[model samples]
Target: MITTIISQTANVRDVQVETIGDRTTIFRSRTWDRLKFEIEYAQQKGTTANSYLIQSDKVALIDPPGESFTKIFLEKLQQHFNLASLDYVIVGHINANRMATLSKILEIAPHIQVIASKPAIKSLKEVFGQYTSQFHTPNHDLDLGQGHRLQFISIPTPRWPDGLATYDNATSILYTDKFFGTHVCSDTLWDEDWKKLDHDRRYYFNCLHSNQTKQVETILEKFSTFKSKYYAPNHGPVIRYSLSRLIYDYRQWCQAQQTKTFSVALFYASAYGSTTILTNAIAQGLEAQGVHPLLINCELATPEEITQVMENVDGFLIGSPTLAGHAPVQIQTALGIILNTATKNKLAGVFGSYGWSGEALDLIEGKLRDANYRFGCNTFRVCFSPKEEDLVKAQQLGSDFAQNLQKSKKNRPLTLPTNNINNLSSDRTEKALNHIIGSLCVVSFKQGEMDKAILTKNISQASFIPPGIMIALTQEQKTELLPEIGTSFVVNILKEGRNLRRYFSPSSINTINSFNELETKRATNDCLIFDQALAYLECTVEQITELGNKWLIYAMVNHGELLANTGITAII
Candidate 1:
């Protein structure tokens, strides 16, 4: 149903209100044409700011959107109810962006008490100072009225430690502030045809929850205990019919991410949410390689957490936005943590968004490079905000870095085979092996949510009877690695001058938007098929053997197609 504007003020502000339940009404402030810049929203989809109004014996307001919707939101609220009648104003979380609108509400409703989680209470005082004395901090629940009671759940993630969700027992609806939300702006009040919204929903999850899998799992488990029938998230359509299915999907996705052995510590501080856009894009790329990303928003993260995560990760990436001419204090503190705690040779990356000068990016790059650290990709610097193309580039760069890390681990002397040159006297067999170069191809596979891939010059037809081919992957010394026998993979043949090999280079692995420049599609076997390649082969591993420094696997071809007849196969 289309939302008709309930109020339009002299300043040309638009606010639409619609009743969803017996006493619950939603005030939506829409921003439909603001998608050209970088943001937390997936695909830069436009968003609607949804604020709820609940009235019973006492009236309560839940989560006011930021200053952008402040004037219209307040105007619409005044038309429906008296300001003095507002008994409580509930804050789901605290951030600098929402302070302006929140302060405006407090000014008009002086007698209204502020309600929030324990952590949010502290932040309220820090931001609002003297005015916060009248706030009410709920331990677990609050009684709004006779039948309209509210229960609170503190769901803390690294990004929002003060996050709170409110449940109304009378209606079985949960006011999920940040959880299970998408940025898409729609006229529909409920998720009626949720199947059609799958892409946007999954994109939102990938951007926000993918890196916070462990925390997501804990929160999902908590949510499972509640008998919530409706999920009224802060943005997008309210979930009713598909709530159970969405929760199940979230659990499965988070489990796959948490089970990955490879991990990267992604440290970033977003001043205007620009840096956050880049961070999300990078994390998405890592996820595709079965590499878990531990994301920390430095502004909200503790020093202890930062130090611990950095020490445990296989690689670390830092991003900051330039304020004036240098990095923010929080980012500087994170940099110190990295220098003091992380290994010197650990793979590192630097990126930043800036308005004028990009000194922050240069500073991070110089510091890490001087310490003899290896960079997974070139330093990323974008002016104002990143565009759609920029986000894709960042993702590919992340994937390339992951592939390089896997290659480096395998090539290390610890994994060298018994027939390695060190074991064999510089013999003719070793020299002959170097001359016998196979076709250069990208082999990728996916099992559940875990994805694994490698760039190799070791693929050749093994037999015609079963239409089989063989691939020799460098052996990994560690037992935690992916690529087990019986796994399925796609072999993408590379054509000359395609430059796909640049992404797999160990010296400078390009992780961001690696696939953006390539023409690709998925095969029947679910492996990626590059349209620019000489040919593509989809196969499943039927047998495996250890062949000097590699795991040789023979696979029966499930599908094959030639993309270009003149496209010469790439050989190393």
Candidate 2:
């Protein structure tokens, strides 16, 4: 009976090539299981590889799914129109995986012209033998015949340097390949349930866009010039109702990263995609420490841009995959730029993967050493393939790098004031760990229409992209302020003081006056927040795990604002 139900749900007909608007059809490939292409999709739930067909007088297909769906995709595509009639295939980007499907498409439709950005065209010619004849790099408006006029825009990011999008004049639908997309599969074709997808959408941005905020801000600016009523992304749903909200949110997320007090720039290039994986783990580590690392793809970044980033960041890390006993040309160029551009006082770290000789890693380490730059950690290296443990270590390296950068900024050292000697020794470990676990903040919530707050130094940041934190709550705290998944709350970081801490002590929590007694204001999420705090993060609970004696809660941060620009986080 279970098998029968599963089979019924996996019906191919559930999501087929269907008309969504005038002259536009969506060839959505739905998967109930994981899409194992990239790290973002690999660990998460299922996703859709959305392909679109525009049936203008000159027919064009936009952003086909990867080779995984080649046979079935070809089969269904032939049912509607003749393969020979498909004139142009507008490819948003080129990857080895997607090239396989493009190969199959060429095998069936030999004369189909491929349209892409200049970078993508170069890749297409290099990958596909026959692509030289029909490849086109559109630098201006592209007429698809009749009313379906189109324009191509290049919005290159670190992860996808060849990213491109198309805008249809008649329908006002922007065919976005990677922009404004989420990694989730659905039977529906439209983004009608935009609220539930908020978390996933934010998570997707964190994974892909957070590090490339500079490029993303440029993309958003490009988007504003377009008169698009909806966005047809290559994953999840067609963004209609949520288009405006998402655009604004993307800007806000980018602004948050841009305005950070201490920033680290992470530069990387992966030969076989191994170093890329390590780079992501390291980025997660930085995020866990509440620092947003600026990611730069050496392959895509110009020398001037690289130099500018190195000059602005407080610290920077460089990672490169070895090729023929040396670093890739891009990395070598970046190394030269780094040596010339960055001051020796900044923190430096190097990491990468290699087949045999790791001279590339050695060269970077040696160069920085000669410059007298301080090393946060040893050079991280992975040979042939990286295991689970390597990723964990890479993440630790990132976390350590962030911690070191933060420590370097502090003018004063942390010294404990004299307390009861017996009590200090009893809980020294937990107390010491608490200081560095997360920010020292008072978490506030509303229970039964009354505002409540708790002094928590254990709210550890868990995910950076989706903006989330993990918190362990005592039984008393749990009962005082209920925390179920999806509930909204605010975590307010405190300024350096002793008065607020005394008010939220275990003995004083029960006897405190009304929340109104404190100088507070309402958050954007409608939760109470202390006006004098360093900053506040608006969060919605995502998961709950029960430990032996404590309840662990993971919540996604929706929005955050710095209340006092000069106020530092309280380290009580």
Candidate 3:
């Protein structure tokens, strides 16, 4: 009889590939909701949990999902197959609660046998109860009558306490619990094409791309010897009959990481903006010669952020200004946190300004060296007011640091293409805009109106102005607004009173109502107004371009909202 395979979720699939007389089954389990931690990636929008089943003579179930999904999984398995007796349960990784759940299965099938690696058996006993007789090594194969058998292969994953890969010799299939899988979600089990495969592989490497590269490469090399037809990983889908492509990609990823030599983190604290200027100059100099620098502001750098940057950064540059013979408190706190948590193999440099005693740079440099950080170059110090010579020296220091980075480096930077926004909708546009605004805090607008009195009152009451309102004022109002240019200000509307009356004009009011109606139609159809507005260019009406037309066509290019500025001589 031909065994059937059922795909339940995007990543999870039930495989019933049989060999000889006895039938075996596999189910790929989804461990994570989305592939990566955050939801920025496009492909990981709707990923599911994965698990696998093996129905040899002795029915074996591999790694199961977390506690949240186990009850449903058990019910589904019982509905399809006989559960009176289970012969073996294989523990791929010695995760405590996952394998310990075997006891729950034993409640129904008390005669079940459990198998794992030598170290895994110890871990199981340590975390769960001591069930010695049932626990055995993968060196022994479980026989599934009539020439079908299941074998265990130990692939040491140092990152995990005890990790092993299970092999089904009958179907030439391998069960890699966490290895050889990417954080990609797809309804299709096999990534038959290069595009999907490449995307998943890159995601896998970039996420787990640190110290496990070598271990992953070793596992791939060992598994390449087998004539494998499918790979049912714990997290993602099964690979149907194509192992060479994944192995090739894994090798390339590992080799690339081995060649990455040096990296730097540039942290600056700017109160009067001089530090920002210096930091940008240094970053530009580093980038000109192919050096990667993780630029961060000392005031904004949190412990978690600093720890992440320290993982791969090979050098550090701390920039601050003197505050009463000491570095700024924020900069000092950030540097202190980094120094305490930082690992070895990183260098440090310090630069700052002082009015009196030159103490801030020296103090920062001393703290860094006390933490055993290597010195990149002599600490580049500047006086109370930096001159042309001081700036030039700072630039040279950056160039020299870049040279040092090149000397220690072996790999090229990973290149990812920019995402296209042509087909994006208004809701998604708003979300992206909100994210950008939150991060950069820069707002600009061409035309909008708010009373100057309201603006001034709000600013006086509250420390900061809210975003997205342009105050219309006259030339005489310039003096009142000059102080708030970088903060908030009012701009003069030249044709003021006339422009105000034009907004209420009968013709202008009719045009505005029509535009609002068009907007409503676009929203109902789920079509973008930007596209509809752009379509108007092809209307082909000669009279629309007449110079004496009273209507002014104004496009809010950034927001894609349309407005018309009217005058008798205005062209449509």
Candidate 4:
């Protein structure tokens, strides 16, 4: 299933496209929530880009997003089909300015060619070298074998390098380069709420307004004659059902150069200068990274500040200091209000400081996780005083948070690997193995066999033997060691003959004899014996080896199995 995991509050949908035959698959990005956008400065929860996997006779991918998105894209592709078999990756205009990270794609499918316009090729080379090769984009038809052909038309756009639109002849789908598109908080790819579209279009226009007119005109002119069944823009939804209407609207809007302005609110809290330090640092970072982080302090910041910031800001950040064990009551209350009141398009993050235990960070993280807030890492405590190391960590946190926020501004999903059992540690491996064995035992025992009999039989029948009979300590060595409850009897057996053991107690001899007999019987059953008394099992040989003149034998069970489960059962 092509599942869409969106940012908590973002409206920018990410498309995860899978196809059977000429089918277009789209995966939407996850949404971001209040705490993410307002406080943490890393408000955007997940910043994975979107790519459309078009499966015709020749598979084509459109505008593979960022590194994270590409990872997910390739993984999903591998899950469905062989990545090495993929034919072409068409670089759409929308992702021209963004770093495509083609290295990742090449890693999966080295032979696959990345098709883009001349300018896009330059940008791709400049941004990602050695991963992609140059491909021509002419106002001509390029045929992919089996009648699946695409017409590439390049139009220089203000925001991107030589934005190009592709027309799939088979599907009559017009891959728009940002010509007939709008910025809207939409779940559905095509034909969103006009009002929301207007708001987002305004945002896009204001951001792209400087050179948008020329780009829009060029795009409209290039495809003026072509009859399109579907309008797939790089940013927004693909206008499948109503192509002409959306195009007409976009044309009129572009001609008018209409711009809309909105506001954003940034709320934050700080102590010992960590959060406060990072808050400003993040804002500066965002500005540096092409996102505007509105800085606000909840102690003095107003609702109007929040509203104003929210109006224009696509993302927000929240920062705080852990008070007692949770976020400050004021920040929590503000978050509650934002959650109840804010419209979609807002992304948030949680940041804070603590003294020792990360209780507050955990609480905030819980809140974010529970509320489905798409957020970055938690702001955590530094021991007592604010040190240079703490500040540096805080700055790094701010930078990462801002990057995620910037990513959300584009409405990308965060694509991360799903951890499997192979990544577990030795202890966890042991536990898992034991569980599997236990489950097998349970299943086996259900067939009318007693648990004790089965377990004991299995244990006794293993080939590995214990240390008791294998090691023979000298008289001087035995005298130097402290004797435990069972050791004295075993020692006596080592010094005296198996039949002549009256030097110790009669009970001790009987115990040793019983142990020996049981071990022998177990060894005979399966050629393996489990000696539970050994500190470490050796597998060098069946006979004991003398280390430092002390005879030491390899601990083995009769059936060649190692004894890992020790000290759990009685020999009798």
Candidate 5:
């Protein structure tokens, strides 16, 4: 049978094939260009789409990448393996982003059995229709000749309900599709430099898994039964050297989420997806205020789920899209459940979007009011698609709800200790750390006789006892000009540095007496201080830790002072 070539190309860099283990080959599609569409790729470190193949008598390919890498990935894959001999395509998780790749795979090799959990099969059928007739829902371990036995674990989370994990009994290699993965691309395959990948891994987990704490924790427990030597994830490097460390980190991260001081159970039903967008904006705001929302789509949720989440959470936010001038029946049902089963004293908020009418918001708010539930913010109504400012307002409304909860007696603060920070335990601490807006400053640097100044906004308070601050520098930075241990420098916090930023950015640092370009003076530490700075800190470098391609400089604040009375610092 002649196979038609069909795949989507992306802004990709290259695709490489390598054999990792016995009968296991990996096709890594790498892109040096950062993804702009997804919030998860905000770091701009670029990414890799990792697809693994295991062959014995039977062959299996696991977790094909999205359309971004689909074209080149398939080409590279065909050059390595005989598609006609392929027996199974094990889908760990299925999403629209990967539909193109899976479709082309089936089109080329029609006899291939697609193995996944029930939900994943459903999703595949929904996307490919009758073509998914070859899909298999694994109920038992599949054995290939020569001891290549595969056990499938259904590790479903709210975000990815079809999340699955595959374990090879013979090789002791576990394939965790999205779990324990980072977005950074590298020349090396194994996590030999896991210390450097810490931030990226934590960032990935925060963006994807933080909100799915209960499910993640339970999955961790389920995975504890398996004895795996190596973890082959869907992104970045494979976990061999840092396998135990990452699993422990996941456990700590999950514990932190469960220990959060406040929780928001968000119930939303959207028609035409307009209300969903508004809900996302609101959730973003809540996250900004350090309150993560447990999102539940009312249409997909069950009555028991509604009761469990509503009864236990510190607060609840309800949103709906008006259908025939009334709330969706699911929304109505959820509202009824909350009104009857939920306590009136619980913090409550409501929002809705409508093209014809917004009576749904009014109905939710009225019912909630009659039930005597305390309102966190006024009901937010949208006529149709929300504007930029409207989204901002929605965010502010979410912030208001979280801020109000902070004042309530039911909520308590969980401060993440700065010192001896080995692992995560306090959820607020992680959230608070991420949310702490740093004041942009032009920091002084010294190497030998050369003096330099560079504008940066990555400064964060690291310790309270010594009043220390941490600054991150890219690994490609001019190390000869960097502040080494015992090197003293001045942090000139910007007052109104928008226009003045040109003096210190794009081409900042390296110039001898760069401060001469601006009005400056010497601090007590003998470092140059900008005259226009809002505040100045004289710091001495104490510790330098390497994180992947970045150098994190931790320094003690020897002396500091506020020069201006104005509290305003950010200049965008």
Candidate 6:
């Protein structure tokens, strides 16, 4: 993957160009030195804003990188071809952040047509204001000459309503903007080091797609008509070799998120992206407890959508940012919807950020309290933007709220299906399955400052080449560390220790940190390796699939050592 440098300056941007296909070149405006404001951008993985240039009898540039790369991106573009040669400047989505870059493009290529989805066109008009007439909304496929016909698909998600994807019929390449994208930057043109990229890709998926699974699934189905050889996404490595595998992975991941039993409707209105950061942290906390979080940016979410989510969820969380000492109009509208549609028995939570007075937080807190809603935790409020400590606190509060909800439902009757079927065969199958036992193990993991462990009897080898193993456990409130794909953990194979299982079993009080009482050593992955265990395998979660109330986590073994060679493996 040799990069052809077109232009570079000391303090300015460095534009690297790589030709991926016959007539397609990727102009990647990489911001390796500076970090963006978004939560995903701060990941420190080195981000790239990929812009593709297609040359045929006509020319088109798809998706100019955001405002940060405005000057240098245009400078690099000037080095290769005349601005007049660029026929179309196609945008996958529209937002205020990219206005500067788009404005620069319009200035340089005044005669060039701008192509986008109908919804995106509206945003373009709003952003461009007086220059709205320069835009062209696409209702049908456009031919760019030399047998290169372009097709646009309007695949909108709640967070990004103006979302669109482009396909080049000539090269059979799908330019999936934001779909199947990670924030990591590298010189590798394809996903050849997929094993190393698993963590970053899964993290990106969880941040964006966890709440948008339904829309993502629909888009996947809609894209099935196209025979795409490569998925040239907006960021990360282009999918040249692992296209089919990535698509299947996305489907499985989204299905698992959507199929969770307990769900939370998280409504928030972010000002300057602060509230969104807090929202993501809290969502991560809920997901760690096996509670599916339905994130809704109130600014984009409709009243009907809010009502539907509140009705289906077991609990709800509301967060907002204060502007002019009041909650945003969108937050107010969401509050009204919640008051009307939500029941008194459902658990509720409130959190927000404010620059000056926290009147908005008090307003939301009072409204929920007056409506006889039970508070899952204390109302959390932070000043201005949340710091690292604040985000961590928010996450911990969310985790505590989820655990409280589960505790309240401890003695509640299991809601079984009403459809009458073969009861005898089901009972026989259950008994037969339980009779087959395996080695009892304690799975422990550490992410950031938090450490957690779980007791499990279901463990088996999933692969031999990678030396992998699969561990399956039921979703529980006390379980703070759900084995998400890309996380690292250690499997401590117990040595005929029945008491160890009891210690790790579910209790009224969470004792996940009970390992402090035992002799443990930290593995290279930073997971607590039990000293008394028969053996331990340091592994990274490779994939996660859901089965009923349990999550089947598959991990690739990275390191292992035998602690007690003569000890027999503990059986369930």
TM-scores for every candidate against the unseen true structure? 0.62, 0.68, 0.45, 0.40, 0.63, 0.66
* Model 4: residues with Cα > 4 Å off, grouped in runs: 1-21, 29-49, 94-100, 127-139, 182-187, 192-196, 258-572
Error of 1 at 386 (Å): 6.8
**Candidate 4, poorest ten consecutive residues by summed lDDT:** 437-446
**Candidate 3 C-alpha error for residue 322, in Å:** 36
How do the candidates rank by TM-score, highest first? Answer: 2, 6, 5, 1, 3, 4
Q: Where is model 2 poorest over a 10-residue stretch in terms of lDDT?
A: 428-437
Query: Please, what are the lDDT tens digits per residue for candidate 1 over residues 247-286?
Result: 9889988987877877898899977768887888888888
Best by TM-score: 2
Write one digit per residue (lDDT tens) for candidate 6, span 127-211.
Answer: 7776777688788888988778999998887667678999999899899998988887655668887777778888888877787
Per-candidate clash tally: 15, 1, 12, 85, 2, 0
RMSD (Å) per prediction? 21.8, 24.4, 25.1, 24.8, 25.7, 24.7
Query: Model 2's lDDT to the true fold?
Result: 0.76
Output the number of the lDDT-best candidate.
Answer: 2
lDDT against the true structure, each candidate: 0.73, 0.76, 0.51, 0.46, 0.75, 0.75
Which parts of model 5 are misplaced by more than 4 Å?
1-12, 269-288, 297-302, 319-330, 351-366, 369-374, 377-398, 408-572
- TM-score of candidate 2 to 2 decimals: 0.68
Q: Give the TM-score of candidate 5.
A: 0.63
Q: Better model by TM-score, 4 or 5? A: 5
> Order of candidates by lDDT, top first?
2, 6, 5, 1, 3, 4
Candidate 2 ranges with C-alpha deviation above 4 Å: 1-15, 385-393, 412-572
